[model samples]
Target: MLENKVALVTGAGRGIGREMALMMAAHGAKVVVNDPGVSLEGKDETDGPANEVVRDIKAAGGDAVADYGSVSDSASAKAMVTRAMDTFGKIDVVVNNAGILRDVIFHKMTDEDWDSVIKVHLYGSYYVSRAAAEHFRKQESGTFVHMTSTSGLVGNPGQANYSAAKMGIIGLSKSLALDMAKFNVRSNCISPFAWSRMIGSIPNTPDQEERLKSLRMLTPDKIAPVAVFLASDDSKEVNGQIFAVRGNEVFLMSQPRPLRSVHRSEGWTPETLRDHMLPTLKPSFIPLHMSRDVFSWTPV
Candidate 1:
């Protein structure tokens, strides 16, 4: 589906990003595999991961190039897109799959924790998309596949930074879809339930061992095909959409919508809201549930 196209996949060193890069290349997309091999918390950078992926692609008769650029930096992000153009002459798809985890409860979260996660996930997505936007506009065609998370879409504990960034990506993807539709550019988000290094970082408790086994079933490779479809003309009509990919289940997730509303002719006073609106809206109130709570069933 991606013959002759050029794809830029950030964080292609490993996990989901690596799978996306490989799958896109297998389908004939010249891939710019961008990865500044960093530890899960964004430390200890190396070029080994990116280089290895490039070698694997080449060995498999697929075109690919390694880009050891940190997505957290605006200049580096832009340079990655520029590298695609320089190497392949054009960039058709951008999978903003680069990310880092800084899990801490909201009260204990430090400035660095918040800033680092936001910069890489939210700001990184923006910078790369902005760089590609100019080219997409000039050429009048492009596709963006942003990696989001159920933690953001629903809720999660000790991930204020991650959840906020992922949710912000949803808004970003929606805005890009609306703004770039005229230029034939499409933007969509994927909330993957994949067991990756990121997921491996989560502290596993003896109580949650069984749940961990279920999570392991949802591998990163399962996410690649959905991203490929979103990036291809096959999904030309799919934009501003959110997809949650579990083991064998693909879900079109719900966006925010009014479940119930209450009004008063006199307008709502604090007391009136407390007494009337509270009672009327109580049944419709969404529960303060974590991602696991909502996804209680074993993925298949």
Candidate 2:
């Protein structure tokens, strides 16, 4: 479906990013597999994953090349997009999947932890998307798939930094969607819950691992098809939206809820809030929960 398209997938060296890169290539995209090849904590590495993915794609009769650039840096991000353009003539799709984890409670979170996570997930997306948007604007047709996480939606304990960065992508994607629509460019965010190295390494016992696997609703491979759909022309009308993708499941995320309140003519007091407003507040009112469902191939 992506025939003749050139795609740049950040962090495509391993996990979901790697799978997405391979899938895009199999679908006829000339892919630029960009990855710093770091560990789950965003440290340590080898270029093996990115190189292996490229080799696998080539063996499968698909075209792809490896890029060992850190998407967190503006210069490197620009070079990644340029590599796609130089190698394949033009870039048609960008999957901003590069990220790092700095899981910690708010009170315990360090400045370094907060900065690093934001740098890779939020600023990294900004750097690469900004560069790609320029090329897409000129072409008047392009696709951007931002990698968000369920932590950003439901909020996981001890992941304040991670959640903040992930949720920021949603806002960024929505604003970009509105801005890029005039050029026929589409931008969307996906909050994925899948088993990957990051999840696997999360300190679990053998029994715990088995139990968690059974309960998992998504796998890395399942997430790729949605990415492919978003990157293809099929999703032309699907812009300014966020989706939660899991195994055979796809659902739209709801917007933030606005608070409704009653105003008093005179100055409010603590007693008034306790006696009147407290009772008036609806405890049964459920906050918006994003939709989740199994998805099949259909036009946007």
Candidate 3:
């Protein structure tokens, strides 16, 4: 369905990004596989990972090229977009799937921990998207498939930095969608629960071991077709939306909506708010529960 399209997938070396790159290629996109080959914690880099994936695509009779550039850098990200235009002559999709994990409680979270995660997940998405956004706007068309997380959607402890970054992408995606809607450019994000190197590193509680197994069942491949769909013309009218994917399940996440409200023609003081408005609004407060509590079910 994406034939003749060119797609740039960041962090395409491994995990979900790899699957997305492969799937996009199999569906006839000339894929640009951009991976700096960093470990989960954002340390070290290599060339082999990106090259291996590029090789796999070629072996499968798909067209692809390896890009060893960090998405956290705008110049490098622009280079990825340039590679696509130079290689395939036009860009159709850009998937910001590259990310790193630095799990630590807020109390113990260092400047480095917070900064690194933000640099990768948040700024990485931004720099890459910004680079592609310019191109998309100029061309009057393009698609952005960004990666968000359940940690950000619901609330996960010990991932303040990661969650904050992921959630920030949701806001960014919405703004981009609104800003680019006039240009026929669409932007969307996916909160994927998949077993990858990043999720595997999280220290699961004893009760979560079985949940981890379920995560394994919801592998990265399950999330790839969704990327392809958003990138293709199939999602022409879909924009500024957040979706959650697990196994065979695809959920449309609740957008921020009004739960309750109160008004006083005479206006109100903190005293009035505390005595009346707070109580009126308390019943509608959404509880912050971990996704596991919400999405637990038999896996496909």
Candidate 4:
């Protein structure tokens, strides 16, 4: 589907990112696999993972190259794009799958926890997309498939930083879609439910552990097909959409929409809002719950 194209996939060292890199290459996209090889918490980095993925692609008779650069830095991100263009002539697709986890309940969350997650997930996404958008603007064509999370779309305890960053990705993709639509540049995000190292390493209760065994059926490979579709012309008209992929099921998530409104002849006072608007809007409000709670079905 992506023959004659070149793609750069950040966080391609392991998990979903690694699978995405391989899938794109299999589909005939020369891939630039970028991975700093950082641990789950973004420490103890190495180059082995990225090199191994590149080797695997080559062994599979696919085309790929290793890029040992962290996506968190704007300069490094620009260099990643340059490598793709330099190696394969031009970049047609970019997958922002790089991320880190710093999970902690809000009150107990340290500054380091919050900052690290935002840096990698939010700022890193921006750096890559910003670099790609510039090149895409010049070429007048490009596609971006960014990674989001159900934790962000719904809610997840102990993931304030991650949830916030992931949600930011959705907004970023949406606005980018609107801004670059005229240029034929496309952007979309996927909120994936997959069993990856990040999830495996996080502490879980007995129930979560049991649930995760089921969730494992929705492996990273299952999510890669969605990324491929988004990257290819198959999704040419599918910009700014958020897709939730769980096992064999794919869901189109609804964006925020107004449900109810209360207007007065004059401006609304706090008391008036409390008495009138609250009652009118209460029925329309969706209850806040953890993402897993909202989608508690067994993985199919």
| Best model per lDDT | 1
Alpha carbon lDDT at 101, candidate 3? 83
What does candidate 2's lDDT look like per residue over 1-300, in tens digits? Answer: 899999999999888899899999999999999988888788868988899999999999999989999888899999999998888899999999998887766898899999999999999999999999999999899999999877777666677888889889988998889999999999998877677777665544475554565435456887899899999998888998888876666889887876667678896899998887777776645554421212223212
lDDT of 1 by residue, 1-300 (tens): 999999999999999999999999999999999999999999976889999999999999999999998888889999999999999999999999999999988999999999999999999999999999999999999999999999999998899999999999999999999999999999999999999999999766698899999999889999999999998999999999999999889999999998988878978789998999998999988999988889999988
Q: Is candidate 1 or candidate 3 better by TM-score?
A: 1
Q: Is candidate 1 or candidate 4 better by lDDT?
A: 1
The lDDT ranking, best first, is 1, 4, 3, 2
How far residue 72's Cα lies from its native spot in candidate 2, in Å, is 1.1
lDDT of 4 by residue, 171-259 (tens): 99999999999999999998888889898866677868778888778789998999999999889989999999998899999999877
Q: How many clashes in each candidate?
A: 0, 0, 0, 0
CA lDDT, every model vs. true structure:
0.94, 0.85, 0.90, 0.91
**Order of candidates by TM-score, top first?**
1, 4, 3, 2
Clashes of 2: 0
TM-score of each: 0.99, 0.89, 0.97, 0.98
Residue-level lDDT of model 3, residues 163-236, one tens digit each, is 99999999999999999999999999999978898998987789778778767887889999899999999899
The better-scoring model by TM-score among 1 and 2 is: 1
Best by TM-score: 1
Task: Indicate the worst ten consecutive residues by lDDT in candidate 3.
Answer: 291-300
Write down the lDDT that model 1 would get.
0.94
